[model samples]
Target: MKNEPRELLNNMFSAAVDAAQPSRCIAPFLPPPPRGRTIVIGAGKASASMASALEKIWPGELTGMVVTRYGYAVQCDRIEIVEAAHPVPDINGLRGTQTMLDLVSGLTQDDLVICLMSGGASSLLSLPLDPLTLEEKKNINRALLTSGAAISEINCVRRHLSAVKGGRLAAACHPAQLLTLLISDVPGDSAVDIASGPTVADPSTCADALNIIRRYGIAMPLAAMQILESGAGESIKPGNPSLASSDYRIITAPQIALEAAAEVAKAAGIPCHILSDRIEGEARDVGKVMAGIALQVARRNQPFKAPCILLSGGETTVSVKGDGRGGRNVEFLLSLAIALEGEDGVHAIACDTDGVDGRDEIAGAFISPNTLDRAWKSRMNPQASLDNNDGHTFFGGLGDSVICGPTLTNVNDFRAVLVLPKSADHQQEN
Candidate 1:
């Protein structure tokens, strides 16, 4: 606990990632590298790394393809690694997606489709709606990103709108034993919600997708709307018999990640309290609540005592009403900072393990007693930054943005609030 906040923050983040490491998650569940043709592949932020892990564990001449976010790709042999857009689909994603469908087109039941999927696959494995072009899908994706819809809601719409997502990917490999290993980033960790459940059966209906689109006010193109409204194409449902031969497993998830972080803190003599692995809400709103909790610990010590770190996970949403470039984590931390209002003896960190928070390069941010003071001296207004939805700029101006690039694995957000009782020495220093 005596370690510097930055060092402790990095350790906690690393520990969380290690807890959900694909290599560990992919081991026991790996089928004996199918006797017939063992095709290994998938798409998402962690897919390329998962593929690499599969190559090491499964002793077979595995060959297949996987698409990951542009900067999230890793090197692997036999299995081709394709880089594409994420949270938004693009032309490269379209090409890689076509390859997946084509790869499974002629495969026999003897062929094993080892789909290494994780968060972001829904966008990374993009294929436009039949009548709508890729550009149209892109517009809808942009709308969805800014719409502040939950991951599940956005993916519900994505599954029905795409040709490669939903259950089509698995259906294409019909008769083949499809084994999908997922690293869940969704709140509930539903198989169908992860990466739009590409290889898993989806129970979400066209109406479900349409309802979410309208709920989020995503500006669906006329073509997109007609597709959903007309029900021209549908995603896999619960009772689909084609899923009989498919296999599904959640290899890793936010729960494990949060637990691991808690363990590390406990070992370090800091009491770690887990809020929930499924926590979700408006980023700033969640931040306020977390801040309230931290204040309780700092002021009242009702829930926990001093020398404790409050931790929580799961994705949060940011409804885009402001012209800010910051991501959910920063937004959350900024809100938390504002709530604390330069309170002493409490420090915190909020970051995405995937190294990307929302669409920004910063992994997250650090908040100390002087956070506001630093922002104020820099001529940056905390409320103004928050108002503009530009948390990224606020922290960036203070040089406090924690940018780790892409760690390539996502288990959602990791928030740590360090609560310390006011000390006489600290008060004197202040």
Candidate 2:
């Protein structure tokens, strides 16, 4: 009763983001000084900050390039930081990725290649394989995003189309000691799914990419299709000698962030249930399932009693059937609002840890028991907005959207539903 539900939710979110920042989690994982020149290359929202952290304590010469989202760049003296478009590939990203690939090429056994890949790398490092133009890669990327395909599925296609993704980047560093450190933004923390596993062994084949395209009905450039069908786009498979000497590890992941948030709740004397850090599905559907659990806790206290928080993390997808502004976090929160129907004793927040959800700069939104009622009074039709995929506008009108621009970390989505029980709410109000 001492901390309001909304404030507690916000605190938990901040804790989650703080736990994943590069400076907080990158130091202990830094490798020892390499024998030869150390070339660092990476791409993601966190790459620039990661590079900066490495430079602060690195004993060896650090020189290389890393691509980050347009506004997420941090000052790094040694590594060149290239700011580029994210969630969508651009010419700048393409150039940066090509340069990275070139830097790792022609390395000797004594040379070391350090990769710092994270979420958004799949788009930030966008050099298409030959015979496939950048324009073609861009088109397929757009399609996969709107096609409601899962992150792993989308990344599979990206790996096959790119010259730098999959295990090819590590392959390019053959004979050199290649070490990849990632801040995982994909569910299950599959090494092969994080930024399409640029420096890890990829077990997926070109056939898997073709299957995803067909399953999603994604239209690919004829040239790309031909490459896949002819097996020319096949990714470097497991057991490939090029990756045999490479080492890969995740320094930060969704699970780590979620557990950090859970600790905050525990210290506050609130029982916290960490359901999973690998949940995935359509955002709205996941919202409904979450609402059901919250209802049980509120009305029956079957799973967890009052004054508890249910925490989860992972990337969720949006099919984007409507013409409205769509951020997966907002989409999930909106659907949750509708399902809960002003149900008392339940308050929740959903956000992407990176501070950008879907295509918007807005991180995400929040929902309270009165969310729907407030919207109805303001003449905002929640259902209509949801139908148009306009959760941002709907939440914005109510001044409930949680906007924390450019947290500069990517661990995927964070959702917290606080079930207070009727007694706690009354106590807080009094």
Candidate 3:
């Protein structure tokens, strides 16, 4: 309940994450029990938690399996939760995906298939198409991630290259009625873009994937190129009959998470303005723009005025040109700090709700009015750190890194900028 900058920002973030937790949001969207069988299958960072929630609430007997990222598994009475690597595919993910496909095969029309999907499913549900080895797929995935490509573009390529994605998984469950409950982490919450739309039809084509590869200059493997060039990797189109019995509901989304944070800010009597829930771009570039907006509100009192909190949610891409040790959230914060340049009365926090930014287990970092001053005092060059994309090191040096181990939910990035009035005399906390 503390209104101090650091504590308030952390509280808002926690609220945002809690609002999207599977247990809180998944119950209302559950489908009725089918006459024959209920099969639950899914893949994502939050899939296991969703399964656990469903296991607790479903009235009828259900059996299933779901794959989640390492360290994200949860216990369920009937459903099995498997752990797999994320942001890149591994043998465990490949086998898990295959097992899911096999599980849904030959189900009767009286059966019901419940799919719990969230962010990170693209990598967690990995199954490379023929002629494309898992190693090659991993290479392509790594390239696309570091290439500054937007998630939708990256997922487009992934859908084309995967054996189970882009509605193929839905198609595999043909006779059975499929109900997919999603925790959206992508901008706009497009059904086809969520985990590459494993249980929904895809409107994107192989040519579109090829165009994204060219746009990002991602080095594609020979087999990958062949799959795209020859159109052999085409995904299930929107009108495909296999998706006739498929339906999906976005149980929670970035907007809902942002609104939760806004409620926290409002409860503390601070005016809160939601910038947008779908802002997208390079992390540093987006940071610069946000910094400009914050500065305008701080100096000119334009926009939303001082003593206000600015909130936004979306996935930002990092080009990873520098061997930085942080994710997009930290990269955005570091750039924001550099751009703020020790501006007074401005504080901010940027973190991924899933509690892993980039490859680090840390969520993200916070920046205060004297963030640069503290860094300089510690012999840390803010500009140099930003250039090296080493936000984890920079923020960690100042004890500003926000660490919350694996929050079993993913709703993309959460950002809060607190701008106080110039005459106010509250010392920055974190």
lDDT per residue (tens digit) for residues 133-239 in model 3: 99998888899899988999999999999999999999999989999999999999998899999989888999999888888778988998999999999999988
Q: What TM-score, over all chains together, does every model reach?
A: 0.97, 0.97, 0.98
For all the candidates, what are their Cα RMSDs to the real structure?
1.7, 2.0, 2.2
Candidate 2 regions with alpha-carbon error over 4 angstroms? 423-430
- What does candidate 1 score on TM? 0.97
lDDT digits (tens) for residues 143-250 of candidate 2: 999999999999999888888788989999898998898999999999999999888878888999999999989999998998888988788888998887799879
List pairs with backbone clashes in candidate 2.
none
lDDT of 1 by residue, 1-430 (tens): 6577667766787899888879877898887756678877689899989988888777777788999998887888788999988677888999998998888877777889888888888888878768889998888888888888888888888889888778888888888889999899888888888888877777778898888877766777889888988987588777688877898889989989988888878777788898888888899999999989988888788799887888899889998878888899999999999999877778888898888887777788888989999888889899989988898888888888888788778888899888878888766886
Q: Which is superior by lDDT, 2 or 3?
A: 3
The most accurate candidate by lDDT is 3
Clashing pairs in 1: 324-389
What residue pairs clash in candidate 3, if any at all?
Answer: 327-358
Cα lDDT listed for each candidate: 0.85, 0.90, 0.92
TM-score of 2: 0.97
